[model samples]
Target: MIHVVFNEPDVTVINQAIELDENLKGDVVLIRDDYAVGPIQNLYLGEGREARKQWWSAVLAGGDYDGKADSGEVDDYKTVAELVGTMRRNPDEIIWIWAAQNKHDVSGYYWLLHFMKEFQGRVFILYLNNLPFINEKGQLFYPTWLSTIPPKEFLKAKKLARPITLSEFEVDPDEWIRLANEGKQVRILEGGKKLSQYGEEYYDEELKKFITGDWQKASKVINQFLSKARQTTGDAYLLWRLKKIVSGEGYDVQGEMKAMKDFEVKQKVGQPA
Candidate 1:
């Protein structure tokens, strides 16, 4: 058995759960890309994948992100290819895809399901969509990310796993195709499997709300935005947007724009504080 998760933090938590429940023994594979952002046009094809890589480079442009552009990072295609190869060689191998209700997980699920169409019966989904779970506080709550759920609660989550239906194999790939063709930069989960796409600037206003006339570290502003916003994206992406806003007339910026910590931002003097 193989477990697939979208978020990196989910890996440690799932491993902890596995230690407690031997029945959940499996190798955990993480898909690295956040499909919710960037251009996903023709994502299944080689050229399309290269284009998205270039888009990520562009997004990381003018930022000091530890030289991600030059690292030649392995993508989801390679990871999925390896999984598909493993399943092909061993018919007994089953795949369990775990996702939570947030856009990041939901979008990753949509992107991955397209590749696993051939193994319909063997592939299963454990989507915690609006489902209540026990938190570390011993209180009931709905988790938006698998990492947020306590390790032991995953024992209960195991029962939610179910095979990807034949109908979904046929219909869901079409939805992914539609989303890819739309080529929008941001995708949001409306509910369930439904996703809505918007432009890159979708979160700009929200980021701006946290910025005030008083100058603050770009990182601080971004942290506040992440903590307070109804929905959030990665800090690197937010920094990119903040830089774009700085390039415009809306905000004043000081210091190098290479990284969040390297700069400071505030609203213009006459702008609302």
Candidate 2:
């Protein structure tokens, strides 16, 4: 058995749970990229390699957007392709997918389905986004990340995992293709339904207040804006938005807005307050 999960944190939590549960047996694989915010056209098609290359080129040009790579040499396309290779090698292994309802996890799930078409093994899913679980306080809550659930709760979820039916496989992949081509920031909810044009709800009105004066530091502006954010948005996404603002004359901030780890928004920034 093999368990496929999104992100490093999920891999850690699932591995820990599996170790404690003597009934569960499998190796864990992590899909380290966030598919929600990047280009997806032709990602599953024959031209996917070139398409991905172009997307990476743009991302690198837009300022440093290093994903959750252990080193500076991580290749998203190769990583996914390797997973496909693994499936081809062990066609009979039972593969379990643990995914949340967010675009990131849902998008990755669809990509996995696309790759698993040639696999001869059984596939099961533990979609936790909508599933309610009893927390430490004994209160039921819907968790957005697998890391949020305790090991005992995760074991329970594993027990309830079901095989992906043929009907689901047929319908869900088509929906995923449709959503992938739409090229919008969207959320994949229950039943493989897509809610398009998301993120507007999280737009902070206070962002405009930072545009005052001839120039302000982009780092300071981002800090100010995020301080009032209604939701927890990734620092990478916020920094990308700031770069777009600079490019569009929406604002001006100095210094090199590098990757998330080394990013620093310097002085002399201008934009609409």
Candidate 3:
């Protein structure tokens, strides 16, 4: 069996869990691209490689708010395609996808479904959208990602994996088409329904106000907000909002880079004080 997930952090957690529980020692493939936020035109069409290259070109051209392009982004997706090709060759191996409810995971799941149509292998998904989870404190919450669940809790969730029926894939292609065309930052739910789109206001309003009060670097502002706020928004989502604010408000791009560097340095040494 092959287990597939969206990001490196997820890969890390799953690997750790696999070490703890022998049942999860199957081949794990990490899809490193983020389909949630950029130009995804023709992403689900044609051969996955060429289409992915085109998409990467579009993303690179857009230039992230920090005015930098991740040169290795295209190579990362190529690696994912190679892994998927391996799955395609092993027609009898069951493929399990660990997907969350958010735009990142759901969007990636759609692309994965589109790519795996030719595989003769059975596909199963541990979809975590509406599923309720109990934290260590015994509080119930709908987790947006597998990273949010403790390793012990994840073992419990693994039992919920269900096989994907042909009908589900049949219904998703057109929905993927519609989603690729929409060009919005949002998630597609079950049965082709769109999730509520999050806007600038969706961010912590107090954080935005705090940042506007002083000319701080984007990364610094984000770090400070995450430390002070009780919300659970992911760093990627916060960084995206920070870029939007920088571009919209004409903040310095160099400062954003410095802030990011400082944050990284702090992380390497110890948590920032």
Candidate 4:
């Protein structure tokens, strides 16, 4: 069975994967890092319900929710615990796909990935930036912090795949909703996953190694990389685009995608469809 836990939930890719096999209706699934359930930051989107509540609690406690951007740190919600509980309950399922925006707070994410890989599940990852790797005497090793992997080792997917820029993981939207209609679970998580990658000679291990111990550095590298990629990618605009295709109820896709924001959300979800 193919199970996908996409970070960004690309409509085209999600749709196409489901089309790859009818069983995808039952095969694919999703889960989040226990940290994901907390209030989001750095990125400029509204928080999820859990995050909103926590933010207000801080305000009530006089801890400050509307602090200046560059001011002192705000305590984040502990969604990682929530994610951990979910994984412990369903450890057998192999994850065909997954993603993350940061690495330091990803123990739950990495633990699950290793478990799935050990079980020989098809594993694919869509990290915000390139998956980390180290080279030793022509050996390529990607480190997973959940468990300390040795420096000169290698871990390739036995039945797993991940999205890289030149070779992105693809899924089709129309097909995904079809599976959703069939009583299968294809959830639209509250936020989106914007993906990018780098490898080969560009794997700059020296200046970037601090990423293994520091999220600020890793996040900085990824942001710098993606800011440049956007010069070419023009942004997939996943949420806006996906809603456009879905609003048509499978109609007017061509014209809808290029329309202005006002038009995209103009059609209601169940308007006589």
Query: Candidates' lDDT values, in order?
Result: 0.89, 0.65, 0.63, 0.32
Q: List model 1 lDDT by residue over 1-273, tens digit each.
A: 899999899999999999999999999999988989999888878898888888888888878574585575746777888999999999999999999998898888888888898898999999999999988888999999899999999999999999999999888888988988887899999999899999999999898898898899989999999999998999889989988887888688889888889999888888875
- Score residue 272 of candidate 1 by CA lDDT: 74
Q: 1-273, model 3: which lDDT tens digit per residue?
A: 788998777887787778788887787788776666544657644554466555445433422323233456435456658866777687677788898776667777877787677662478888876888887788998887788877777788789888887877888767777766665543434322354343333664545654543345556677788788744355555665555555543233443233243322111123122
lDDT of 4 by residue, 196-257 (tens): 22221122222222122222322233334445431211111222223323444422222332
TM-score of each: 0.97, 0.76, 0.71, 0.25
- Off-target runs (Cα >4 Å) in candidate 2 are 62-91, 136-139, 183-192, 197-233, 247-252, 259-273
Candidate number with greatest TM-score:
1
Candidate 1 yields a Cα-based lDDT of 0.89
Top candidate by lDDT? 1
Pairs that collide in candidate 1 are: none
Question: In model 4, what is the error at residue 257, expressed in angstroms?
Answer: 31
Please report, as a residue range, the 10-residue window in candidate 2 with the lowest summed lDDT.
Answer: 263-272
Name model 3 segments beyond 4 Å from true.
44-70, 73-77, 137-139, 185-193, 196-208, 224-273
Model 4 superposed RMSD (Cα): 20.5
How many angstroms is residue 167 displaced in model 4 relative to the true structure, after the best TM-score fit? 29
- Report the alpha-carbon TM-score of model 1 versus the true structure: 0.97
Q: In candidate 2, what are the lDDT values of residues 1-273, reduced to their tens digit?
A: 788888778888888888889677788888766666555667766586466655555555544455433343556567667777776787676788898766667777876787666563378888875789888899999887788887778878986678877777887788767776676553434444464445422333345455456555555667777677543345555566666555554444455667543433432334323
